[model samples]
Target: METNTQILSTEDLRSQEYFLNMGPQHPATHGVLRLLLTMDGEIVKNIEPDLGYIHRGIEKMVEYDTYRQIIHVTDRLDYLSSHMNNEAVALAIEKALEVEVSDRIKVIRTMMDELTRIASHLLWWGVMGMDIGALTTFMYAFRDREMINEIMEKTTGARLTMSYNIPGGVMFDLHPDFVKDVKAFIPHMRKVLPEYDRLLTGNIIFQRRMKGVGYLSAEDAISHGASGPVARGSGVRCDIRKKAPYSAYDRVEFDEIIETGGDNLARYQVRMREMYESLNILEQLVDNIPEGPYQMPMRTLIKLPKGEFYQRVETARGEFGVFIVSDGKKNPYRVKFRSPGFSNLNALIQAGRGVKLADLVAIMSTFDFVIPDIDR
Candidate 1:
């Protein structure tokens, strides 16, 4: 037996590496983020995130604004979790002032935080499907999200950038229809979530696209300071709600969803399971909402005692921390926010490398980051 084989020349094997700009205007980047990706064919060799496209110098602005005025500014950072962001500042102020709000306010704050979380997750779910080519999921997700949005609007009087939380309490009491609508929507969500699962979660294509893709280990997640579903998916127990209870979170019974898979599918599952946990929390507290004034009387001019105070809350994306330094004045001497998206985005370069170009979308989607939050 005789066989002949021909080898290719060096010039035939040479390949040029090229860069692809994901956005300062692309849909997948989600909010003016530009990702400069280095690629070898379809495999991603490196990722460099170019931020500050939407930077507003929020921290510098906070120095001149009064304590009360700072509440509104926080909403713009992560508009999807506006209420929670407001809560972080409010809680910090309360601690500085030695103010413990009434039970009614605590319960209401907890309810609103959960609602914000669910709404954020729903939006992420819709946009995630759209990124992956399932346009129908977007429609279904928004349809249900509108119901929650209406509930928020009725109580807070603003949709996305709702400045609902105030120092010592919420700005207003729950609306008359608030409990009723939430009660109705709970069962509705219970019904619709399964449909969402059937429509996409179980789809073989989605599973293949997500499972074992964008893998991050527990060590890497911690090193990157990832939190919420991003950290939870990699088996990191870094939930602020469970670890350090604020408002009425100490009184609620809900599991911190954890997945050890450390892939896109794992992150997806963590958020999906969290929705049910949020519903469970609402079910327990909606009927038992104590009757009391939503807020306490405050002086027209708000000032914090000279010192530094810090507070952290579990937002839909992750742990949002607020650090305030006051000099016994109406305005803070300095203010800083340890934004979750900024820390989580740092993990992108690590997880995205070595994965296929398309898998990067799944990885970024799993992070569910808001660019304004990162830019801030």
Candidate 2:
């Protein structure tokens, strides 16, 4: 629903173009994103993101560390859903080694990954709402997020950056209470997510602010390699978890939530739908926790073969792929992190072409980026 503002003035600064930078620090721009806005007065002409504020030398850091020790650093890459980072790296290594991950480990990994997805979406819902002037939804969103984080900590010993998943298997064995607690969380999240409809989706103010704002066409989103919510927002059913199933995704049943409009409101709707999808996946996986060994014991001098291996997992943000080129050594010869935010950020430059300055922030939050994901 593009706003049908009547053509009042034909030449109010449409005759002249001016340039303005939106931020590396604007809260609404999300994280450390500086937008170089070329504008004809309030209407935007172009946007270029000046990224790399949060670079931490993560790719270089992995070269020196043992394969066993590298999962900790993966957590730092996407701090929002660190477990997925840990699992992505671990899966790549496991694939390279051709090691058999146990059924128990596989199910647990799938369960945790879905949980991380929910938690990430929950946080995104809050901050995105706040970015557009809805504060109460943030609190409501975090309330469930806190429960998920606490469940994570109970199993992995740390809430946020839990380096729980590892190469051969998990760093720690599953907690004895993991089953009951996760099952409890499933119903709780089920009860709470519907409240989102009342709090944000159904609100008149939010619908007006978002509805048709920052629309991305399906072809444009695909051309840019946008994944997760960004891709799904455009009705692109491209969840890597389903496309290339790794880590037990093949064993679970879930749909990639998608919408056609690709607007700010559509993105909000997609994530809102995703919280339920994740809960659906959780309920399916939680009941069938397999009983088997968690991890196989790796030799002290574990070495990757002299070939390149790629593993792409669907993280909360998007497709997180780790391309590891191992030269038959303890260290990878080259490492590539296909960070989702970086690919999704390309959408900002593409879609910002003819939007208004005030609408820029609304558009940016739809991508749900963290700067380090781009910089790393």
Candidate 3:
């Protein structure tokens, strides 16, 4: 008696490529973002970010709103970077109108900008750890972040979307305790940041998950227009604050954190180090805040000349730019926003290729995306 048997070919044993949808409503995404991932078994072959779930048509709305009104809408784009978003629009409007804000206003804006950076980074740090299976980090991060939120509420009357930065200057003067609160927070944060290093950064498990994963080269970073920690992690000097000084950034001394590793770990290190740099910027400004009016005198209706204007600022994510086309009207004839999240998300298509599905979560966390910013 003989048995009939057949051996499988190499191609027959191999797996076929398939598609997976990560989210428009997944926890790791951090917002309403859908990632259409092409998968070859457990490895990601390509990633297409499906946006617009949270798009509010902010740019189109701004065209109908006054320059002052435009400031408020920008806050909704990158709510974590709301202050910086407001500043971008305000700076563009001021540039179009040829208004120079006072030195005091400049200093206050810079200090607040740094505080916002710290707060945003804190949130990202905690969330990133949580994304990779460390829940304790979320609690610790929010603990420090609350202090900054309280400070924002006291001064700007809002925590998430302050809309504090107006066209001419900030909407109001700093709270009487602003400097004292910031001064106290700096020391507290400096002490606690190291704890974060011990808790997550040095974890052997985390290191294994991050190191050498999702490599994005410096040249690719530039070609993809990646900025903030995403670019800096790859050793690209794309910090708008350093390259083109705006507000009181020129008055401060702080190093732009750069890591040449071009991996997920490098991005993580860049942000972690950036928190220290933001603290340095705050220490220099908090005590030395000048004595002057918080806001410049401006016409009730701000009308830009019949021309175009653009301003870019370094936000928590990266370059946040506002461009306006005016037909000599109180409202802009056309409006556009250059948001960092959109560019950074696009770069993932390259960095994420050939990475594991699990590693995709780690790589995306490093991006620190705000979905509305991408969709808008």
> Which ten residues in a row are the worst by lDDT in model 2?
4-13
Best by the lDDT measure: 1
What CA RMSD would you report for each candidate?
Answer: 2.1, 3.3, 2.8
206-246: candidate 3 lDDT, tens digit per residue = 99999999999999999999988999999999899989999
Q: Give the TM-score of each candidate.
A: 0.97, 0.95, 0.97
Model 3 lDDT vs. the true structure?
A: 0.91
Candidate 1: C-alpha RMSD after superposition? 2.1
lDDT of 2: 0.84
lDDT of 1: 0.93
In the range 1-376, model 2's lDDT, one tens digit per residue, is 5344544357432476777878877778767778788888689988877877777898998888888788888888888878888898899998888899889899888888888888998998898888888899799989989988888888889989899987888877878888888888888888877778877788898888788888888999999988888889899999887788887788888887879888888888888888888888888888898898888777766799999999888888899999999999898888889999899989867766787887787888888887777888
Question: Which residue pairs in candidate 1 collide?
Answer: none
Per-residue lDDT for 54 in model 2?
79
Error of 3 at 168 (Å): 0.9
